[model samples]
Target: MSSAEAAVPQAQWWHSFYGGLQKMGRSLQLPVAVLPAAGILNRLGQPDVFGKDGLGWNNVAKVFAAAGGALLDSSLGLPMLFCIGVAIGMAKKADGSTALAAVVGFLVYYNVLRAFPEACKAPTVLVGNQCIDYASLKAAAATYQNPGVLGGILIGLMSAWLWVRFHRTKLVDWLGFFNGRRLVPMITALVGMLFACLSVWVWPPIGDGMTSFGQWLSDLGSWGSGIFGVANRALLLVGMHQLLNTFLWFQFGEFTKADGSIVHGDIPRFLAGDPTAGQFTSGFFPIMMFALPAAALAIAHSAKPHRRKEIYGLMTSVALTSFVTGVTEPIEYSFAYVVPALFAVHAVLTGVSMAVTWALGVHAGFTFSAGLIDYVINWGLATKPWLIMPIGLCFAVVYYAMFRFIIIKFNLKTPGREDEDEVEDVTKA
Candidate 1:
């Protein structure tokens, strides 16, 4: 094993500190979790109770409904909170400097795309004859929007990196007030904005290329769903899934509403909330919520008798995290390092999950992972949330059983299945 692999056992102070920040970020989601529930309640009955009249009990209900919606949007909106969440969770040191840097990076990314002329212009393919005048294109280009989540995440990563880079820079005396953490965020934000502005000015075609790519992916339909599933898992390794998600969910497609208005946003709105939106997320519910957890259990059961307890503890935490927050790294990494085939199987299962959901039109959405919390939230608010649970549970059982059987039959080198030498050392140690 490499030094990095061995280092995993060290449990460095930085790891603990970062873990604490992640835990805090996780806790922050609880209150935000309430927003989805409230939105569901209002959607179900509030509108009817608050008549369409300008003023009355119905109007009162509308006010409440609107307030709830706004609160949910502001608090839980991925773009609004992604920077803070990521910065806090991923930063080596939990400080205001990192958080502020993330914010700066996000703003830079947003404004850069927003200012891109090509970004504003609608695709000629979509708007054929309507694209007559260059003036219209210019107007449209000026109105282009950014993939907020993508921008935010990039900003957060950049900010964190910048903080680390400048934390020890000399010139502390001359730039005393702007040194350290405070200086990092300030510098990051300024740099990001400047980069964004320059990119827009120098590379108008880049935005157009991205728009084209999004459209191409959108056109893939069921194949697109499968690709997304595979891609999502792959990106998870590098923590870039959020960026892919932004393109697919928000930038690439247009969702038509019941009243004939078209809107652009993330996949969750279309799959779980919007009445007229397509069921884009129908495919993920099964793999994320059920299958992966089952696999975790299977690996646990197959663990060596001596290591079983430790493996079980790890798997249990991973399973709960997967179910609750949809974060699956703990689980994926558990077997991925030791058993490559199992990871491949896991990836295949993910694709299968998406294909099944897409074929059934069982749409769902999640703020985090495809776990139960998001399932419940989306289901409660979705037009067909009930279908997801039944389907997901069935897959979960299959995953667990198959994984268990495979480990025993193949003698897979999963967690807790180390060689005799290691096992002896572990026992002795």
Candidate 2:
């Protein structure tokens, strides 16, 4: 077996780190998995189902849209998903009790954090160097109470570790009530409160940072979107690209409806029938639906003559996955570490795609990843959905040529073209 296949030794630092990241990734599955359904429902709710303008709203669509509201909101669906997913993913025995503790923990964490700025009389920071009055700000901030996905992930990790550590601990006979699963909730609550209190000092700086960066991106305009796109692609290596989206897609600024209703986030605004959604997300469509798939084909074509069959099957499957499902990790990971330079170029091209999408005023947000499925349903709402296809075709050609040229010129070890002695037998697709 290859050294990469060897099991990481127990109780080591790297093992612990790896295990933690794996847990975070696993906890994301339930929440992430549900988004496609939310996207479908939201799209079904939109008036223009067949990609044409002037269709009146459908009753069934409105019902689906209303029902889907529960799932699409970050504070509502995502937190609960984090609670259940983390508890289940992290439990040694997958006990219902662990999940129960997680629920308690999740509620307490956000409640405490939200109450902090209020209890301390911290003024609500607003757009353009203005702050709302502290008394009124308390009510508005309390109403929002969003911690983003990172908070949920952290709470999950903490609660999971606490569950594993103390779930089996024995207490003195007189205090046995606090020893088992029952005790987990109380302890988790206290920990939640502690973090909530800590967040007063911690959360605001982050908000400020996001505001500053958001302003910078806004100032840069189309190029800023492009830069964000590239950064999003590059951050996949560290598995934290969603951090950037939290600001732009969520609450960097407010969106006022034509009827004077207010909303937050790209997806929320889009679902609320806004024409301009998907500022940060739309660019990903061209890259995922066309460019990367073409890159996959190029990888297949460039493989050694003897390995073409295996390469063909693997790349084709991953290409389809990227185009249809909006999941590009399989194709990306195939060459991520092996050909870092090519990945950098991919990031640049992603930036360019985002710039082009924004420049053309084409907008369509997704509840999940950007792909053909979302692009189709959201087409009518988009400014120029037709433009995406032609742009994507162009990007596909660029990616294909780029991949072929770079791989051949540098003798990069991409999948089937890897050195004979270093073949990776496991095919992810």
Candidate 3:
């Protein structure tokens, strides 16, 4: 094939892959948006808070914790939530049928996995009577590591695909009731069973490998965290950061609570009271709450004297948004395209912040972004909440100095620095 012909197929593949990632990223937000509620409720019920003796709200704390635990607990929590969210989000149309099918499919898949070992023969047998070892089977089943959110995501995507393909299917006269969207759940139930059976053999190795990989990431410590930080920001440039987050925040690690229920991923583990749960997430406090906001100030300061007023309001709004809500998109997009090098510098600084906080043994968790709201709400759960302020202050200085120097030295066209016509266009917008 000619070079152009070869490139056509490659380009198509790239677009297809990119499109899928974008869809998954958007779909993931549905489930993620509920996390803050879970975090707040869980924190409210902890012993150090309203649950304590002097607080005179011990029973109230239990109620709040139970309500929150219903969302974060292993049995019917995040994994199941993801299934419903992803299914509806990814389907051609967000329908109740899709969400219902996702839940049914996940339950069937999960129960089948649990029930399979008992139904099958055990590896060991008694030589005397050649009896099947039911005890071993039960033990084996107990030892099975639930795939957790990863499994939920897999089944959710499958259900969505099924919905897209069969939501309009016709059926024979006698089977009319199961036609179109209604058929989706029935078909998913069978598919879920099949996947469960297949998972008996297919999932063990994959699960083990994933567990080992999680361990490896934990062992990498600051280096793994820094890499994640850099990638998180860089990927945000293309709106793919959610894909990265869904894995790290929802499926990265495994922790078993005192009650024997296991929680997976950094966020869930943290909510479950795992002491080491926040390493992958804590670093963002400095970057989002301080550094990027300071960068916003630098951009506003470097603008032409006459143009500063025009851009100051925009900069200030984004800065406060970053500080209070940890939403940095408004600030990032301003310079992401105008001066790509600054974005690269911003990404690197983010990585440094991650590494520093991680090395300093500072641990914090957030259900959403590293905003002041989450910082305060989750303060009791953090190892060194006060340390974040000091770290954030340092990052503020660095971000301000670096951004100002770069803007001035390179004469970069950030916000108000555009040519007169361009500035007029921006200002008018």
Candidate 4:
């Protein structure tokens, strides 16, 4: 056989699926890394940061809030970030023009939707079924917020892919005016318009579906949140869970504020000072704040005594990352890559944690991940905040015991416990 044919082995469908996920995870790094700074800014600016006593810095708080919130909450900010981040991440050359083209394409996509709402609406999914929340849906058409981050991601990837394909194409001399990078943005715009028009025709049913799903999840109450929590962790394995967050956190509800004003999305409503913001997010506190760190400790403890120090160093850094920022992927993927079964258990535990917390009627909001920073930031506005610490401690013990037993029993190679070559490699890191 030829060298290429001999080296390449056919794989099952699951191999392709996993390969795609790994690629997605790599592409997400840039966008994800930028979140911490914005999150910190938002935490600083949130009300009650200075407490009821620090009345003097109230204006300062507002200034900080505006400064940070602008990056996330502003119209251009998030879409632009996604476009550029995804473009750079996916491009082989990582060209600046690729990123610029992506941004322009994304804007063109939304601009079309905004300019012609009626033309965009598909026939009602059930003909007579309410396609979407009428007033809010209409508002979204004007504001063009429903497409959201998922929309930005779709456009970003498309723009980048188009740039890569046609960027170096050579045109005849007569048509040379529209050659190279100059041709990219224009073609990207046309593609964006096509997708936007398609969205106009296609999104009604999808929007209706999103609305129905949100309503169903809300109706299921804590149980629904628990299932959502499980799905969240499991999907995170493939780096797709953020898509669900877009619906639940941002596009789910017509949340009303204390002033009798209404807004869509949990985050925007919470920032508007709504108290119901935490139902979907609060469940993560126990898992991130206590359970994951505890699990990390267990993994370290299970390592051979000679390797304990090295294991401790790696786990300690990742565990700290998880606890402080709710960035669990580092610690999670470390083990999940080696012991897939253990990851399943982690996902299940996350569901139970969310259910238990929601059942107890605790609520807390976070702009970032469900890390300690967000938990503390929203605590003053949270429901049953005091119960979180005690409950979290209980979870800590449970995760520790469970992870230790499973890893030891299975001899799972979780970081420090890897075989000879893996051990040396992990220690170096």
Among these predicted structures, which one has the highest TM-score?
3
lDDT of 3 by residue, 1-429 (tens): 899999999999999998888888788888888888898998888888887743869899989888888888654587888888889888886689999899889999988876644232445543332334565552211334367777888899999999999999999999998899899999999998888888777877997787787678678898878888999999988888987777678777778876666777888788778889887899999988999999999999999999899779989999999999888899999999889999999999888888889989988888878999999988878888799999999999999999999999999999988888664553453
- Give the TM-score comparing model 2 with the true structure, all chains together: 0.80
Q: TM-score for each prediction?
A: 0.66, 0.80, 0.90, 0.81
lDDT scores in order: 0.61, 0.75, 0.84, 0.75
Candidate No. with top lDDT: 3
* Residue 359, candidate 3: alpha-carbon lDDT: 88
lDDT at 113 for candidate 1? 60
* Local lDDT at 237 for model 3: 87
lDDT tens digits, residues 1-429, model 2? 655555445347686786666555555665667767877776676556622333554666567766666666555565566556767776677688788777788788877665544332355554322335656553232233345555666677678888888888889999988887778888989998887677666776776787687778867868988999999889787665655565576555556644444566667677667776667877888999999999999999999999999899999999999998799999998998888898999999999999999888888777678887878777766777888899999999999999999988988888888787687557655
The local lDDT score (0 to 100) that residue 219 gets in candidate 2 is 73
Which candidate order results from sorting by lDDT in descending order?
A: 3, 2, 4, 1
Q: Which segments of candidate 3 are over 4 A away from where they belong? A: 117-141, 423-429
lDDT of 4 by residue, 1-429 (tens): 887675556544567777655555567567756655765675667656742444547777777766766666524556566667777777668687898789789888878877653422543221222234454553222234346555777787888788888888778999898888878988999998898888877877887888898889878878888888999888887777765676677556766544343455666555556666666787888899889999899999999888899889989998999999888888888888788888898889888888888888887767768888777766666789888888899989999998999999988888777777654443453
On a 0 to 1 TM-score scale, where does candidate 4 land against the true structure?
0.81
Residue-pair clashes per candidate? 5, 0, 0, 1
Instruction: Put down candidate 1 lDDT per residue, 14-74, tens digits, no spaces.
Output: 6777555445345334333444554453443343435454234765665675554443332
Error of 2 at 384 (Å): 1.4
